[model samples]
Target: MTQKYRSRARNLLHLGSTQANENFNQMVSSKAPKARHYGGSSSLMNRVSATVLQKNEGHSYLAKDLESIPDPIKLQNFNDFVTFDLETTGFGYCDITQIAASVGSSKYQSYVYPRCQISVEATKVTGMSHSIATNKLYLHGKEVQGKCIRTALLDFIDFLKEKDQPILVGHNIASFDVPILSRLLKEFGLHREFVRIVPAYIDTLKVARKVFSKEEVNGCYKQCNLVEVYLNIKYDAHVAVEDVNSLQQLFTVKLKDKCTDEDVYSITCKSCKESYTDVIKNKIVSKVICEKLSKDGIALQHLQLANRRDPNGLRVILREHGVPFKKCEDLARKIQEE
Candidate 1:
């Protein structure tokens, strides 16, 4: 017996440590604690499965599961989807040069003469420019007759009224297009008519992020890139009409079945009034900083309150959440000015 005990002790010393076993046991204990008896219940199996999922996938598994859960409300038909896109003069306080929307075989496109100059960069990309001398709009160096923004908006609202409260979907619309459109609607005193026709809107960029794995999308969710990745064809981009067409195709092929009505954000939802992403959209801070702030669950209102209470403390908190010191200072300064 003494000789056998000595041999077992030597073998134990040669074997690796039991740290992995200890961790798994700890996880199981956390899931099914001894304080509550679960061994005889069916929930024990679920607890064990959850423990295994956590052990293999980490905490992100919970978020993935939540995202996959079906929403209680579903759209009656997919045919009601109206995909749209816009071409603008510039980022903030910009004018919309083009508006386009499509539902099935029906389509709408209009050019609006802007009250401001189209930036040279925008002109280069959109190939739209206005000649104040001629009082005319030109696309690709050809003269094109266009309507004033007020008239153009009224026309667009009329186009929307043809459908019965259509679900408006656009790429990056939540962060970019919707805000611009909302401002213009209010400015033109057409907010009530626009919202009355459009009950909800979906940001396909957000849907793509939720539906596709990061690896599947190759870590880039740009509209052009997504069209190429999913549709396997490249179309003329930057033109609002062509953009909407391509987006409609992308949605039909990839996202039609994956989306639910609950994914649609209400046009009149008070909570949608402001978002943390607006900081990035409004150019108050770099995209990287705003993304980190969102991941840290910080909202714009919270940041505003924090700034009002303890501006320096907000910077420290932002820095602790991985925002660079210079970016933190810039964001603080921008928020203060706001």
Candidate 2:
């Protein structure tokens, strides 16, 4: 079927299923992971009981209005979504330094003080060093203040709650961000409480990899790294807010059109495939510009690559033309105007 027809059918099915208000218990949980065990008990059960009993201060409405709530997967127009990103201290997991999320125009961004020291490698990549994090250092092209991780998590949760718990969108979030968030929430004894508030997620990283499986750069494969996917976009990486902004653009342009009711959680992405695709795309883009400018015209024409939003593909083309960074930017403007 044509993409348009498929989308329309998907929308119709979503609306019809949603209005039916299929029993939550009747709904299969194949897509969702087993609820994390907290102290040898199901956190989801605890949350459901807490909500049903109206024992929670803010969740009284949940008790009165448990049924008829739209199942996340059955939403027709999935526009009510939030994109979020994180900058962490290191790769050890959950040592978040900064977090940012945006839904439509609303935004929530803040830096968090890590419980452990930021690693040199991570600091080099993210520019969030231990000194800067501890001393409230200025990084990522701005002054940053640090909040405690638990406090940061709560604030982000509050932000999600305030936003009505929209679908969470993020790059590589399924693998990294969600687990870290869950771990942090559990560590702080708020997992069961807050897990109920956060909504379903759309991991752009997985979606992009699956949909754009054929795209390659150089001879290597690529996965859904925000930096690589948005190579043409000139945004500093490892900054939570900037990455989310890029992610938002990618979702709108590339991933959103392909979003379906199939539980993304259930769709397992091939790490090897995504990784190879990512590496290939990166190498081809950079190698073409940084190494092989001779194939510029063909690359620009055939690849039709984007480096951010260049006016008429000016930035990338100019780079291939061997223009210096400063001069090429000026020339790009002139070319765009002409």
Model 1 agreement with the true structure over 1-338: per-residue lDDT tens digits: 78866655632332234675688899999989989999989999999878766765567667643232111123663347899988988888998899999988899999887767899999999999986544578899997767777788899888888886587889988778887887777655566568657756778988898998889779999889898887788987899999999999999899878886546665543322346556667777776555445433355665676777788867876676667888888888888889
User: What is the C-alpha lDDT profile of model 2 across 213-314, one tens digit per residue?
Assistant: 444433222223533645556677677888787777777776777886543431112221232344246443333232222211122322222333446565
**Candidate 1 weakest lDDT stretch, 10 residues:** 65-74
lDDT (Cα atoms) of all candidates against the true structure? 0.75, 0.56
Once superposed on the true structure, which residue ranges of model 1 sit more than 4 Å away at CA?
A: 1-79, 269-338
Query: Worst 10-residue stretch by lDDT in candidate 2?
Result: 266-275
Relative to the true structure, candidate 1 reaches a TM of 0.58
Each model's TM-score?
A: 0.58, 0.53
Error of 1 at 95 (Å): 0.7
TM-score computed on alpha carbons, candidate 2? 0.53
After superposition on all CA atoms, what RMSD does each candidate show versus the true structure? 27.5, 22.7
